[model samples]
Target: MIQASAGRDRIGRTARLGRLRVTKAGQALSEGVLVAVAVVAGVVVAVVAPAGIAVPAAHGAAAVSLLVRARTVAGRVGLRLTLSAISVAAGGLHYVLVDQMGAARHAAGVFPPVVRVLACVGIAACLGGAVAAMVMAATENGTTLIRLRRLLDGWLIAGSLFTVGWVLLLHRADRGGDGSASFLGLGRVVADILVFGLLVALRFCLPHAQRTATTVAVLALAALAAGDVLRILPSEPGAWDGIPLAAAGSLVGLFLVAVAPWLPGGVSVVGFNQRMMPVIGVVAAFVPVVFCALAIAAHTVAGGPIDTVMSALAGSVLLALGVRQGVIHADHLRITHESVVREDHYRTLVDRTSDVITIVSPDERVLYVSPAALWVYGYRPEDLVGARLPLYTHPDDRETLMQAVQILRQDAESDIRGPGRRVSCRVQGADGSWRHVESTINHHPDGLIFISRDVSERVAQQVQLEHLAFHDALTDLPNRALFADRVAHALRKRTTDEAPPVVLFMDLDGFKEVNDSAGHAAGDTVLRHAARRLRASVRAGDTVARLGGDEFAALLEWEAGAPPSSAKEVAERILTALTQPYPIGTMKAEVSASIGMAVAVPGITSDQLLHQADLAMYAAKAAGKGRIRLHHAEPPHAHRGTPNG
Candidate 1:
């Protein structure tokens, strides 16, 4: 029974989850349908609608649809619904107003003064309510009042021009003594213009994310403005009148507005007030110029004094404003040109430098490589961009470079700061040669900047200098200093179970006599030949050095458990090679060697070993030339020598 109950509980939970998913999907579909209806209705009115009862009906339906959709919004629900209701009421009144205007056109006195007044009031209320709703929606989305205040200058300019134009039109109408119908028509036009201006300002004031609904509302207002203008302008007989076009625009605009509540947030109008405002301002500033030209043309054709006087006034105002705008535009161009020049100057400087500059991301990927990389690494900038820094780095040096980069990334993220890090590594160039580079990595918020300079030549020169410091000038072999250093190194590396290193010291028997008999150059040739033979006779790991003129030494490293006789055999080989004839500058010369040997044991220093070998060499010389001797632990009497056989 308990198991059955658990199964029933699981079924119920599963059903509920399914219902929730379905509900979400349904809601999304409904919203999509509403937006589609709004867009279709707006496009129809803009492109194909005729001024008729159908236009008002379409607008009314669209407004009602929007009001219904607004109820679904969670925030400021009551305010949105109220505003939508007022907009709907305004739309309905506008339809009636258009119908009455059409009727009054056919039959005089069909639209009475009271009815006209009521329609005008209703239209005003509708426009006001729609603007208020849009503003409230924007505010609810976190747009501050301070941002709106910044546009006061633009509003003032637009309002002043609108007032002036309206007053001029009214004056002209009064001078002609137009009827009540004309006044009413003028009132409608003025109202439409005012509404259009305010809606435009509101669209500009709202943030981009909150602009979808507002944009639809502005489109609706634009349609109404268009309708008013078309009605005022005369049309050709038997052609499609402005009435149908006006009504169509109004219907489409209102439909779009009504569905705005359900529209997805990403809808954007391409030419918003942010871009259009500057254009509008420039047009507004030149209004006097356009008016002056028209007035002059009118006066020229009609010869009216009033037109001439108006033209003069307009021309004066145009002169002042044109000069001001010209100066502002000139200054703007100057600043822009200077900015471009400065940027180009710095770019050229970076491109011409010898150093290779790179910007890398935190992941060690190269984001940018300067043009100078062509000369420095034999690679174009594009070749290295987006490649990993470690790709071109030597394998042996990557770990060290990565460690430095890791530290740099950490420093960028942490409060601890210092100057950029300097690292030296081998970077493979495009020619497949490894070049030494000294790089300084500077950590920045965006990425790391690596300033690397080629140091291959400098490094090679330094190595050469170091080598020359401890080597023989003539023989190109290790000098006394390097020889002693090697012996000390071998002693320090010696273990208890390993065989100790052996040192062999030797002096040329007849080297000084050759130098006296032959020239010093011939002696040099003999010494060079002997150095090569000595090197050939020893193991590759052994160090052979020339201590001084006619004096030489060798430090031989032996494997553990090798026989002690190995050292004696090496000394005998050196003696045989030394005693052989050497060619000296197209002549034959003869020389021999007396060699002394000592083995490095525990507790024995390099200096002691050298002294013992020197003493043994002297003992070999005393016995006879061309002999080999070994040093013993006791006194000089214990030393052993191999006699001439």
Candidate 2:
């Protein structure tokens, strides 16, 4: 069964790897195809072809290539535009063929109205579709206001260039030609200029990823516009002489537009720099206005003729510039209002928060503190402004706080940015009481920022929990765990020449009798009194603890070069004290104690010493009540004592 499963898994992995390889190979082939198309288009434009058929032949080839590419990319818009180009190319090629056939008979080939109409329609559709696509993309991605601003900027730049072109070049071209032909040529020029302007707007609005495709489309439009402009310039040959240039430009442009959708996907996914849009708009609006003014001034000084057409063109340019400025001013006002509102919202949050925020300089002096400090630290913001941080922190915790600040500084200076440092310390309030505060320190370019919150209540709760874990509830004495810990510590520190530590275990003689006769309340009172007497019997450094119920224990440790007390003497003292009467609510109850004493020896564990003491305690009980027994394997000895306290 395992072999069969493994074979299936291996086959699945092989299939997945094969698919990945095929995908990579397909992408590489597509990129190569685009590069080849671009190179071929470039060569065709640069190399001249036969006069009548060159333009038609170029259009047909370009249209076919564009159609194939657009279909490969599955672009509906691209397909629509390329199909129109195919129709125009077919008409042009048909005319060229017929004209060649007529010239063989030495006859003039009359241009058909149908071919002219197809050419006009094809050009209009291509230019208009491109402009529409840019407008749609911009509107889909940006706000209406932003689109309006971009549109105004585009028109401003395009209108300025159009005015300059008219005043300098096209205005002098012969207007005595066929009126319809002149109008058509003028229409084509205006369309080219308008499409170029829309391209500018599109470039500003799209993100970097999509911008790659937009940039390529912009280059294609620029080429088409250049050819159109050149065709109208005054020349000896007929206007048809510019046909080859326009055709070459169109051939390159169609291929470029087709390759746009196949660009790498990464270009469309990156962020765009929206901040530069305003600067670009300002430059685009002003530079042309200034240049036109200078040119008009020069023309006036030179006594050149300025006609009504020039005046109208200049006025239109000025009008577009005015509208562009208005849009920019409105955008500026909107941004300013938004910034003020955002600032007010953040200010409200800071003022209302409970956490204290402080900014300190590198010299350790506080630079600024938020208003929350008044309640949290009992100091007004102004009072702490110039104060050093260490002065406000508890003396014991000052070094810790300073160390944290140094670590934060190192983190800020390091190449890899580190997270904020958090430290807990005590801070002095205005009332002179120290409060536990947890602070997170972050490095800033100016200095450091400290955000502190009071945690005194939490610390108090934690301390109380720790106390309850290792102390007896009824007597408030150390429990067995705490006593054993101290015994282990003292034993580890003992020297060979010093007195060994002693462990004493005691059990009450009459505790159960009191509980049965006077109830558990009286027994508790007796236990409390016994614990107190046991503490008084031992030295201050020794540990006295309640093991549980009526049982008790004590650890006697001696200091170096000090008077040492005998373990037997301490046990007798405890026995005498425990035999004393305990007052319980206006009555008296008496209890007797039997104590066992064990002296520590070399290599003895705390538990082993405790067990030995326990065994001695049984021996004391066996010797009768109110007796102290010493733990020894050689001889059994007991000290019978009477109540002395």
What are the root-mean-square deviations of the candidates from the true structure over C-alphas? Answer: 18.1, 10.8
TM-score of each: 0.50, 0.66
Q: List the candidate 1 regions with Cα displacement exceeding 4 Å.
A: 1-335, 415-417, 634-645
Please give the clash total of every predicted structure, in order: 3, 3
Q: State the C-alpha lDDT per candidate.
A: 0.68, 0.68
